[model samples]
Target: MNYFSHNPLNRFSEIRPDTAKMGELWRHEQARVLVVSNNLSLLQAEAREAAFLQQQEAVALANQAEVRVYLGSEGEVPYFALGFAGLPPALLPEAYELHDLRQVALQLPQEQSALLAYARGMVHWNLRHLYCPDCGSLTYSTAAGHVRQCSSEACNKHHFPRTDTAIIVLISEGDACLLGRQKVWQPGMYAVIAGFLEPGETLEQAVAREAEEETGVSLQSIAYHSSQPWPFPSSIMVGFQAVAVNRELQVNYDEMEDARWFTREQIVAGLQNGTLRMPPQFSISFRLIRDWFNQTGAYKLEELVSA
Candidate 1:
């Protein structure tokens, strides 16, 4: 129930969207231009409407570009501009940096982050899946940029945008939640156990499986905490609270570097002054942990700090 305000990284504005895109002719006309980040951060404002109208100017400013629409909530919310690219990995980083599209949402101002993230993720999916996997021929976008269908009649394949489900679980005992640090993580910091959802596994099952696999710590009664639509390419991180069934600590070195339990006292210090530090406030993981403390009524920080 504890929600964060416009805490910069914490903002993921809910823009109730309705996608009316349909038919082949309409898809042909809808812009396939690449949207840039430079425009929204600099020129955008609450009262400013002119910046949203200047679609041509934005295209002209780009070094190399294509024509795409800025899919916004109303007529001109300017969520994120679209770009037309066949293969994103081949693009030059200096001239035009291509991304997974999910990470972009994390970097933006929170108010429009989720909206833009959703738009970009679905669009990116459409870009790559232009051909039917079954027939190896061109496919077209459908469902208002939400789907792709093969052009070949003999091998008609329909593809939908994917959102792989994963869970980030905070394994807690009396005063501690078991945390692990990945090889890629910063020093002195640890976080909840996480993993991808295997075939037919429930969110709770995924949490238990991931925690046991990563740290060899069994979890019981995992409860959903919160969910954030993470775009890193396309993932939905569902945060959870799981009771520690077994206390023995074991680390699966293949998945994690260090895994251990951190007491509430240490968590308090880390939340305030931080050690090697934890996940930034922009991430849903931080919010889950923050809410955990708030639920216990033992700790509460006034500022919805993202750092």
Candidate 2:
């Protein structure tokens, strides 16, 4: 069974790799476009589904777009994303609302939510990569927006979309699991320890390092659980669960405001009494916590629903 992992778009990598092939998809009459402007995605205010625009409306905006990516097809209909950086909010139509991807994910259907995340990530990449990093030269998008080619005659290179890998692990010792809260987060809200994976490090190594650095606890028995596409800009969250060697609370104040182990009973009481809140059901964090509770028989599925 699917457990709230939001990715749904069937990205046709083979077709998108050919620039000539993507040109035909763009001209197809049945093409559907997702318009993103000023870090917000466009959607119908009433129905809240992705308000796909036809070629006519899309072409009009495409004329002024910073970049456009071919996001593959759903059956016979083609899909594309048009990005407009710095577009004014006042220019948006009254019938359509410019909502952030986070809000759109919660409001839109599974497919639409996945599509919006793709659009947001591609647009952000395009905006930040107008110049080549290899050589100080201008770059142009190629391969149907899948790659960027350097314009410099002396130094030519290709750049592709980037997704940073991060590890989010729940550390457990016996019946209790460790959770940390950042100072900026709401009071009593805690989640798993997470950090970006450094070069030459495996997922398990990253998990161990992050756990010790943030919570000062060594972890063993590292096991992979699942992963989620977190498209705030672009990130892939690799989820894992591990057993802590010790249950000491030595939090790095610079990394997190507070850290502590919460027993299953305490966690349940926190939720029941409104003293703590887990990550929303839409995120992998929630699943990691819930999975632990279920596996340990800390709380029944029905108890979580009522709490």
Candidate 1 residue lDDT tens string, 95-180: 33434333343454454454445445555566567778888999875444555778998887888778888888878888777878
CA RMSD, predictions in order: 7.0, 2.3
How far is 214's C-alpha from truth in model 2 (Å)? Answer: 0.5
Give the worst 10-residue stretch by lDDT in candidate 2. 1-10
TM-score of each: 0.71, 0.92
The clash tally of candidate 1 reads 12
Model 1 bad stretches (over 4 Å): 1-53, 56-72, 75-80, 86-108, 270-274, 295-307
TM-score of 2: 0.92
Task: Find the candidate with the highest TM-score and give its number.
Answer: 2
Q: What would the per-residue lDDT of candidate 2 be over residues 151-246, giving only the tens digit for each residue?
A: 998888999989999999888999898988999887888888899999999999999999989989997689998998876877889999999998
For model 2 the local lDDT of residue 221 reads: 85
How high is the lDDT of residue 195 in model 2?
95
Q: In candidate 1, what residue range of length 10 has the lowest lDDT sum?
A: 2-11
